[model samples]
Target: MRTPLGGNNLTAQQYESYPSADDTWTVSFNNSAGTSGTYEVYAVCLPATQAP
Candidate 1:
């Protein structure tokens, strides 16, 4: 997902998912210019059998 920053109003880039045994995942976001910022990213992982 891409989201616009609150102040700069620029779209943030995001990457998600990493292989794990517990059905876990990761998320990262950066500014439009490819700079890391203070943006907050939240993600949730459900059981393998409960995922959509």
Candidate 2:
């Protein structure tokens, strides 16, 4: 779980991981500093607890 938010123009980023046997988890992004921008992505899902 990584949350990095920047300001003075805004540049927020987040990353989460849960992949090895593959339970499906992948989120990639890249603008590479090309002009023209508009971005807002959010995902909050929590309901997974099993390991006893």
Off by over 4 Å in 2: 1-28
Q: Tens digits of per-residue lDDT for model 2 on 1-52? A: 3333454343334444344343455555554444345665444657889999
- How close is every model to the real structure, measured as TM-score? 0.39, 0.30
Task: State each candidate's clash count.
Answer: 0, 0
What Cα-based lDDT does every candidate model obtain? 0.57, 0.48
User: Cα deviation in Å at residue 13, candidate 1?
Assistant: 1.4
Residue range 1-52, candidate 1, lDDT tens digits: 5454566645565655565555555666556675444555555655557557
- Clash list (residue pairs), candidate 1: none
Q: Compared to the true structure, candidate 1 yields what TM-score?
A: 0.39
Report how far off residue 3 is in candidate 2 (Å).
20
At residue 32, give the lDDT of candidate 2. 49
